[model samples]
Target: MYKLLFAGLASFVLAGCSDQSWRTTDIGDIMPPLDFTLTNEEGETVHGEDYRGKATLVYFGYTFCPDVCPITLSRLGDTIRDLDDETRDNIQVLFISVDPSRDTPEVLKRYTDAFGPEFIGLSGEQAEIDAVTNRYRIAYEYGEENENGDYLVTHSSAVFAFDREGQAQFLMRDSHPVSDAEADIKRLASQGG
Candidate 1:
């Protein structure tokens, strides 16, 4: 399975991304095949291969995120719904936790469930999460708890859009109404498989 995932990732990077219009400042530096080892809600070991041929939307945030995370996730769902079925099938959404201390696999899964089953939530060792965040050039830092004992994680609010081949194509900045992200996803799908 790992081998197959690795092969798929390579293919995604090599596939036709010639007309990519998204910029590094916008999408990020064109990245090579990105490999990550994370466990799904079931605690089953998963790699990038499990999401083959799918344009993935990845967000790095904690489940406890009170405002931005929920708003962003709702927008993601709206963005997905805006797409037709055929386009949606070729896409996947990943909710990865930047807060490892409390976000176990079960916690991650539950958080994602509120968003939708199609959304996959993952969290692992602090070092592992940090490494991936660094690779994507996302900035994040933990915040202190309030009087109610609820804390916040201030993080980069961008959502990354990867092509079906798993190649980075666009980094949708956290902006209003998600129409921009919706447009980009459609544009990517229209580019052809």
Candidate 2:
């Protein structure tokens, strides 16, 4: 009987140590916690800690992106809208512009406003942007300018999700369904981390 009890106890302990099943790739142990210094859409300096109390989703993209950026933001917006009111209110989407040279504060504000109130646009000097992008392993490059001085920025499309305490949680790729994203954000919010 004692042997059976010990076996059950060990099984219970091991189960407690198991990882939570997340639809996206679990990045809790892989990525660094959320940290950055950038300017908000209102031109105010903001740090990662400013958003510490909310579950944050960070996406690196430019407002001028013709296709990928808009679609990603729209999917995130839909995910947020589908959540419960409390969970939705406790989540924020940070859109970091990779092309700060052309993405001004006013432009960022106007662009993010189209997504939803939960979406915020941020940008900064080249060095600051580079630091944050490198920290998160986000890659981006500019295409050659056209005759009209127009160019495109090729950037990584992964979105990083952080818990309320600013700890890295998971990465949402473009292929993840909106429902999966919604479920993850809901879990993060419910955990109150």
Candidate 3:
């Protein structure tokens, strides 16, 4: 069929890709490494490099994100549960706090633990948080208090998937279902451990 012929031609061209297509790939391309070190709930330092050699599900939001963070985290836990044990071991779930000003390690731990232990919660100082957020192109705005000094932060809701060696691969929007994420993980895991 015409479609099959076109696909074969596309594969042939991809095999000899040139300067024009250097940054694109059908399976997704490698993005810059995120070199950051933050303190986990256990008061231990964790670096981006420590998660190399496995697919990592990364999300940038606060524990206080009423709708987005909790849903996304829950979906991630569910997606992980749906995976086979080996795939689960090869992947890590990270919940990075955008509200470093208020999200302490304990708070993060508590909020994330309610979902699953496999989820790691990280928080740091303002500068450290800014650096990581910028590297991932995540936007967050906080401040302004209510009568009771309660505050709210508005941020982007996205689930970014990274391959081994710390390169970005895909991003799941707030509307993307857990099934979409599961398919992605299964495909990546198929490439071998």
Candidate 4:
């Protein structure tokens, strides 16, 4: 199962994303303008609408994820660091945990803060999480637990970007260069929300 998830992630990430510019086309083929209400790392209620008027990067993964999650997040952090202050401030990264049972608000907050202060971690009741994931077509399932109660979650690995207008714009994969992400984010920041 883990292998299958990784294979899918690799395929998604490798899907011909050579263009460094923000894509305004073909967004209608998938759901656009994502919205959700969940608790942030601070344990406060946060609405997806709050991220409007800024370029937002939304990723789904748990703190316990061993490989793909951290690698992609680190790239995102580095990409943000490469941007100018004005552009950086205009961008927001949202880390939404699929494993809500183990990923409490505080835990989510602490995990995301390691990447950057600009990153916001979110998780909520199972029902709320289900709704968000289903709407976004994010495939995730919990793996069998080990004796220590540790388990792995197999989930889609892709970074989605929302323009300042709150419209879903583009997606970047793990294979994409951080510089390309920076360029795309800067382009999104320049657009009117």
Candidate 5:
């Protein structure tokens, strides 16, 4: 009887040690296939469905954003750069501009292109942009314009990651480390189409 008890206790301990959950906190309660229509940086219309077979990292911000946007994009760039070539090929990054009034397709392209070739910029009319933002529950308030017509936008700074199956699997905050993001992206890419 004592032998049986010892074997049972060892099994329990080993099971606990082999937990498969990701170490980083995941905020992906909503399952994916999120649909949206927006204009790409090349002045062409693009649909989210076009990325159905690939993993995507979506960030909402504007070209003129003073701090948070740049920091988040830079970190994402670093994370992508650290990924292996095959993983990088399986992933795409999108920067959606909230300030469509100022971030035209050309401006958005120039801004995102600075990060990397795989990074694409997206923008549309305020209503369309609002539709997509509302779907993701992103809040952004455009500030009053100054004498030079420059303005500020207060917005949510969350970056969303979708799996190859188009399922929302992770919501990465600005505070998360680049290594953590790279791990998540690799896992998603390994899932294949």
Candidate 6:
């Protein structure tokens, strides 16, 4: 599953190579427009339309992830920090927990707060999560639980970027540099759609 995700991303990147304007893979045509309904950190139901006027980045992972989750969010925080105040305010990072069984709204709030004010955590019932993941072609699965009832979730690490109008724009892989992300986000913010 992971390999399939990687291959898809690679093809997207390669297809975008002819366009030198974007720093990351241009997915404006291939990816779907942003759409989902999930519970926010404040335990309120929110839809993707609520974020319509901002350049949004959505990442699927779990709060309990040992390494990748924290590092990815932290790097995103860094990317936002590098932007000017106005551009920073115009961007949002949505952290969607794939492991909703253990990540309640309160837990998600706490986990995302450490990243930055621009970061918001969201989760929902399994079906809602599955809908969003499937819409984006993201693949995630759980590992076998240990005696302690702890398990790991293996999920795609790509970050989906959407323009201010909720249009699909680009995709960022883990290998994409923060500098590139920052630039791409700034461009998205300026475009206002």
Which predicted model would earn the best TM-score? Answer: 2
In model 2, which runs have C-alpha deviations exceeding 4 angstroms? 1-19
Model 2 agreement with the true structure over 1-193: per-residue lDDT tens digits: 9999999999988777653767778899999989999999989999999999988999999999999999999988887887889888889999999999999999999999999999999999999999999999999999999999999999999999998899999998878876777778778766754
Per-candidate TM equals 0.79, 0.89, 0.81, 0.83, 0.86, 0.87
Which of the predicted structures, 5 or 6, would earn the higher lDDT when compared with the native? 6
lDDT at position 163, candidate 4: 76
RMSD of each: 10.7, 2.5, 4.6, 11.4, 3.0, 9.7
Q: Which pairs in model 5 have colliding backbones? A: none
Off by over 4 Å in 5: 1-20
TM-score of 1: 0.79
Better of 4 and 6 by lDDT: 6
- Model 2 poorest ten-residue lDDT run: 15-24
Clashing pairs in 4: 165-193
1-193 per-residue lDDT for model 4 (tens digits): 9999999988777674644335323353476686998888777888888878788888999999999999889988987887788778888899999999999988887898899987989999888899888878898999999999999999988888887767777777666666666677678766654
Show how many residue pairs clash in every candidate, following the order shown: 2, 1, 0, 1, 0, 0
Query: Which portions of model 6 show Cα errors greater than 4 Å?
Result: 1-20
Q: For residues 1-193, write the lDDT of model 3, one tens digit per residue.
A: 9999999999889777742221212224544665688888886888889878887778888887778788778887887787788777778778889888678888988898888767889988888888888877788888699998778898887777777767776777755555655677666544455
lDDT of 2: 0.91
Task: Report the error of model 3 at residue 91, Å.
Answer: 1.0
Q: Candidate 1's C-alpha lDDT?
A: 0.76
By summed lDDT, the worst window of 10 consecutive residues in model 6 runs over 184-193
